[model samples]
Target: MNHTIIISKRISIYIIGLFLLSLGATFSILAGIGVSPVTSLPYALALTTPLSVGITTVLANFVFIILQAIILKEIRWKNFFIQLIISFLFGFFMDFTIWLTNGLPEATSLVLIIVYLAISLILVALALLLYFTANLPTMPYDSLTYVIANTWKIPFSKAKITSDMLNVVLSLVICLLFIQSFGAIGIGTFIAAYGIGKMVGVLLHKLQPSLKQWVYKNN
Candidate 1:
């Protein structure tokens, strides 16, 4: 049987990973502790301005893309199309997930909140790993990591962890000075800043072999 519609295996994995990433981010915010360091600045802007988290995320990603060009000293528009696509999809999925999970009750206890945080960390880490396995162009935030890593001749994980910490610090300043509140810098944020890095390291060790077999680009 010849099918009119076909999808690649890696694209399927990417979509699944994207949805999980959105759901994970939603749960993180709903936990009321904090957002992940990667998203903390966007969350702060969302709280301080009329823009939703999705809008802020989109905008922030665009900025990151620009930063990538600046750092690399060139613009490869053809190669960057996937990054642009993923950026828009990330925002859309995040907002859609927030609305879809609107019925979840607010966490009132520390235990429940911690559970949500744990789930958020794992989902995010897994989502990223899947993205790697898919072998697609990464989101700008991650692309920036590669830019930094290659530029400095350092490991990707080290670059990413350091970037996460720096982003958290920048977000904290934005929250206190402009947002006039703590924004999203709770204990969970700190945990995610460091913990997610460790989790991703451990997960990647197991994921590399599987990832070698998957190639995401469309033929």
Candidate 2:
């Protein structure tokens, strides 16, 4: 019963995290600035193609899972399938959030854009921390970081940095190729690239004790 309760709590937190994650990303795109580095490609693809950002995100994350298998030279069929399910859930969640946020007017003023970006970063950071605390199956994009680090025998930090840079570059290429302009790559990407980690670190530092009590221990 105890274990079941723990699992239930974790799943509940994970679902909340997933929804917030979608909300954050959607706001970033609609802020009229660049989306986060991790999301830039999908944002660009969504702009250039008929597919929605959510659909592009799902397809991109699916590729990440495949790339992980290729890097490991081995596949855990169960984890692969779990990640597949998560990818779709995340995609659908994003679609719903996009619909919900679509009613907001576009951010135009510099201050408003900054406000939007700030909200985006904060939600993403907090959502990721909640998701991690839940100890659930890892998201495929995040999973690729450790996969690359282990495969190359490099530190996780280096792997993450490299992965982010590659994502931004590819996003830039996609924008240039398809749209003939920088459609979804902007200053906001750089801000998110650095800000998200710092925000996450700050949040974890501030909330670790409270989270440990409520999330991982007796509430």
Candidate 3:
């Protein structure tokens, strides 16, 4: 009974984490400065195509899952299914958050931009806290970084950098060729690309112990 309760609690935290992640991403998008690195490609695609950013995010994540399968040469079918479900939920949460905040004042001034950026970073940090603590089926984009690092015998940091750079490059290409707009790739994109990880790390260092205590109190 204790084990089951623990599992249920963890699941709840994971779901909340995913929701927060989507919320942060939405803030970044609506900020109109730019998006985070992970969402950069999808944002670019959405700007050019008729698809909404949420749908594009789902499609992009699916592609990442496929890449993980190819790289790992095996698929954990159960975990893959869980990831798919989570991805769908993430996409939905993003769309829902966007809709919820649609009436908020426009992000026009430098102050709003900074506020949005700070909010995004804090939310992302808290989301990461829940996500890593839950220890659930990994998100495909995150899994890909692990697979690449393991397969290539490189440092995980290097692998992650490469993956991020590739996504940024793809986002840039799509914007240049199809959209002819750079609106989605701005200072915010660069900030997210270079700073989010470090910020998450700092947050983790400070918060992980308290979070662990809270979640594992019964253990």
Candidate 4:
């Protein structure tokens, strides 16, 4: 496939992915659950530094990009731009959703909470679907762990678990220090995201049509 054409076709996917990411963040906020690691990092840094969340996220993403380039030399123009778009759009949409979802009661009843949780699950599934459908490149955090595992002869599953644990700890501490209301709901959100993402990947794989035509079209 022509890289340029693929980029054109996938740009909407990237945009919708960002929208889903932001939407997920909004749902988390509404559920009063903890935020994602990369998302939380910016908020944490913003608290201690003079930088805005947007700026901090850009810096963090760029650092990851550099690390990824060093560890895996597969960096290219298309992937680089995709990474940039992901980071920036995620930050921007997160803020937007936060503002939009604010002022609505968190959850008035158990049913409402369940409803919120269900929506969150769906949003996360959509995020993963769009993310992979972009067919551009994986995020640096994900790629970094994979590369480190392969290079150092560590178990990939173990590496991923360790990384996720670190993120959970960091997010918990930040939420605590900031006095954010992330409790069992936060854990639930994490589990739901994991489950939904896995399901999406499985389903997409099973349903993926032969790409000959799509690839040819892009070419």
Per-residue lDDT for 78 in model 1?
A: 72
lDDT of each: 0.82, 0.88, 0.85, 0.64
For residues 1-219, write the lDDT of model 1, one tens digit per residue.
112122366677788888888888888998898899888877877887899888988888888889889989999897577788888899999899889989887889988898888989999888877766776678889889899999989998899887788878878888899767778788888887777768878888987565644442223
TM-score of each: 0.87, 0.96, 0.95, 0.70
Best by TM-score: 2
Candidate number that wins on TM-score, 1 or 2:
2
Candidate 2 positional error at 58, Å = 0.9
Instruction: Tell me the lDDT of model 3 at 13.
Output: 89
lDDT of model number 2? 0.88
Tell me how far the alpha carbon of residue 153 in candidate 2 is from the true structure, in angstroms, after superposition.
1.2
Q: Let me know the TM-score candidate 2 reaches against the reference structure.
A: 0.96
Instruction: Give the higher-TM-score candidate: 2 or 4.
Output: 2
Across 65-143, the per-residue lDDT of candidate 4 in tens digits comes to 7766786667766776777776776667766776777777877676776667667667866776766677656665666
lDDT of 3 by residue, 62-177 (tens): 98989988988899788778778877888788788888879878889989988888888778878988999998887878888998999999999999889988988888888999
Every candidate's CA RMSD: 3.5, 1.2, 1.4, 4.4
Clashing pairs in 4: none
| Best of the two (3, 4) by lDDT | 3
In angstroms, how far off is 55's CA in candidate 1? 1.0
Stretches of candidate 3 off by over 4 Å are: none
Our tally of clashes for model 3 stands at 0
**To one decimal, what is the Cα RMSD in angstroms of model 1 from the true structure?**
3.5
Question: Which candidate number would show the highest lDDT if scored against the true structure?
Answer: 2
